[model samples]
Target: MTTISALPLLDGTSIPALGLGVYKVDDTTARNSVTTALEAGYRLVDTASFYRNERGVGRALKDSGVLRDDVYVTTKLWNDAHGRGKTRRAFKDSVKRLNTAPDLYLIHWPCPARGLYAETWRALVELRDDGRVRSIGVSNFQRHHLETIIEDSGEVPVLNQIELHPYLQQRELRAFHAEHRIVTQAWSPLGRGAVLADETIVAIAAAHRVSPAQVILRWHLDLGVAVIPKSVTPDRIRANLDVNGFALTPDDHDRIAALDRGARVGSHPDEVK
Candidate 1:
């Protein structure tokens, strides 16, 4: 079993540095995957309203025999619910579906053109205040979006989930996050598995005798970036969390750094709206 460590968030709560992401997966698969992951020692499970599988995750968590408080659950508010009323209602629906309050709740996207993320941010703050969510954060937000929310609400998010991988390292945004004491969580941390077969990553994996996915995830861990790599395969789900054994070398970091081509496998934040 991997000894997953925790990263302290801005709100004085801690998050698991590596976790399972249930994006694009259906309910049955998400349920099975979450159950298997928990049985395999994974403590964090990431889901979202857009994923439409929160019920499955909730079911698995309840059935997994793991204490609810022992696992860190994160769910997101969808783009359509970017206002106080809808956001609150969406959160309530999510809680009912999950059968419990989430440990961390995030705004799925900034939707800047909608000009209502600030309202959604206030809703999240109120959720935190109401004890519906332990910590609140945002996903797919740029620095400007982050600043806007903080300026209006006087509250900074605990973390920011972004599309990050060796091929699309958001160095500037990462620096901004570091400066602001915001933990950077990587969605699509493997570049949607595009980086799994890269020559450099493969070479490192060969040296370490681990899967290329594990190598990339280990790289994220080394960089202090929290990762939620999505997979429905039981074996791959187990392999993704089996990354606490090895350490990447300086040369490995340089090789992976050289692979940064500013590529993205997900939508650009500014263009999402």
Candidate 2:
């Protein structure tokens, strides 16, 4: 089994560097994928209330026999649940479905149009104070959105999950995160398969004798960014966790860095609402 690495959060908790994501998958697929991933040595699982598979993820965690403390489970509050009261209630509902408080709870989107994210951030701070969650963070938030919440609540998110890959490296926002001691995590880390066919990535994979996906994932790991690659296929699921053997070279980083085009596979933060 691969010895999965981890990244430490400002809140004093650490999350596995690479994990599995359940985005469009159904409950059955989520359960099976979580089971396979746990057995294959993955210690992190990222899901969201929007995914509607928290029950399945919880089932796998309960039956996998991997002690809950050893597994880092992260879930999120959906856009519709962006208010102090609604955020609190939405978190409880998610925990009820999962049968345990999540180690990390994230706001799924900024939904700036709704103008409730700052209020939601205050509620997350309250939840943290109440011991309802281990830590709180945000997803798909741009620098301005992060600033709004941080400035209003006087609490910085422990991590910011975004659509990041070689095609969209997010260097500017990442620098802001570094300034605030916030961890940057990648969603759609593979660029949703668009980055897999790049000649540069393919060449790196050929040189390393691994899949193009592995090369891309290894690149994110080398950059100290947390990544969650999603797949329902068992072979692919296990293969995604097998990137511990090799490291990316400096020349490889330069080649891959040249691939950035500011392309995005997911919705932009400002357009989500």
Candidate 3:
């Protein structure tokens, strides 16, 4: 089992640097995958109400025998659930489904078109204040969305989870996050298998005698970002966490940096709504 480290968030809390993501995983698969991850020493599990697997994830945690305080679980409110009343109610529903208060709650997306994200952010702050959640963050938020919410609510998100990978580096947005002390977390750290086939990443993996996925994950760690790579296969789930052996050189980073082509396998924030 690999022991992952933690990074401190701005809110005086810490999160496991690496975690399991159950984006498209079915409820039954989520239960098994989360159980596998926990047994492999993963202390963080990222899910969302949108994923529709909170019940399975919650059951895994309860059955895994891992103490509640030892795991850092995260869940998000979907786009349609954005608003003061809806956000609070959505959170309550998630807590009930999760069978525990989530350590971190996030605004799943900015959904700028709806014009309710700012109000939704305030509701998240309220949840944190009410002690319903330990930390609050956002996902897929562009710079303008972040600024708008911060300006409106006077509360900056503790983290921003985004579609980031070797192909879509989002350097500018990451810099902005650094300015605000918000941790940058990559949702699809592998570029949805796009980067796995790139010659640059493949060569690096060969050099380290590790799989392509490990090289990409190692690169993500080197970039000072959190990553949640999802997989239902037990072997891949275990392999994803076995990235602590080798280190990436400056040359490797530069090579991967050059591979950035502004490519995104996921939807843009502006187009989501």
Candidate 4:
């Protein structure tokens, strides 16, 4: 079995650094894909309520014959469920659909305009204290949002999931995460397949005798970011997990680092509300 290394969170919990992302995949596809990934030796699975496939993910988990404790599962609370009581209900619903307790729970977005995320954070904190979730974190949060959470609640999220790839380095936010002992989880780690065909990434892939996706995933690993790359195809899912064996050269790393243009394919946190 080829097991990738794990990343430790501020709470002393460790999560697999690479996982299968089930974002747009539907129920049937998500179930089959997740089953295949588990059978292929993947121990981490990322899904969310917004993805609308937690039930399928749960079915796959049961079908895979993998123990609940052995697999690290993560799910998120959607933007609309940002208040304390609503977040509590949302967690219960997600857990019911997943059919297992989540190892890490995350806020899907900041949603500052709604002005409910702070209370949601408190509910997450309470969940952590109540032992339903092993760890809690946020997604698509900038440095300012992180500061607000820390300032208001006197608690720091264990991880921050963001749209990160070679093209959007997010250096400052990553630095802030590091300083605060928060793990940086990359959600569109391959730039949603946009940059995989780039000449630079292609050349790096050619030089390494790997796919461009592999090269980009390697860059994420080298930068110490946890990545979740979603794929319905069996081969692509396997290839995404087969990035642990190679190393990217210093120059290659620098070249990819230079590709940053701050390009964001997703909505900004402040605007998402």
Pairwise lDDT winner, candidates 1 and 4? 1
Each candidate's lDDT (Cα)? 0.93, 0.94, 0.93, 0.92
lDDT of 2 by residue, 84-182 (tens): 999989999999999888999999999999999999999999999998898999999999999998899789999999999999999999999999989
Off by over 4 Å in 3: none
Report lDDT (Cα) of residue 236, candidate 2: 94
Where does candidate 2 have its weakest 10-residue lDDT segment?
1-10
The residue-by-residue lDDT of candidate 1 on 84-160, one tens digit each, is 99999999999999998999999999998899999999999999998878999999999999999999999999999
Looking at candidate 4, the ten consecutive residues that score lowest on lDDT are 264-273
Task: List model 4 lDDT by residue over 30-99, tens digit each.
Answer: 9999999998889999999999999999999988888888899999999989999899999999999988
Worst lDDT run of 10 residues, candidate 3, spans: 1-10
Position 50, candidate 1: lDDT: 95
Measured over all alpha carbons after superposition, the RMSD of each candidate to the real structure, in angstroms, is 0.8, 0.7, 0.7, 0.8
Which pairs clash in model 2? none
**Distance from true location, Cα of 215 in model 2, Å:** 0.2
Best by lDDT: 2
TM-score of each: 0.98, 0.99, 0.99, 0.98
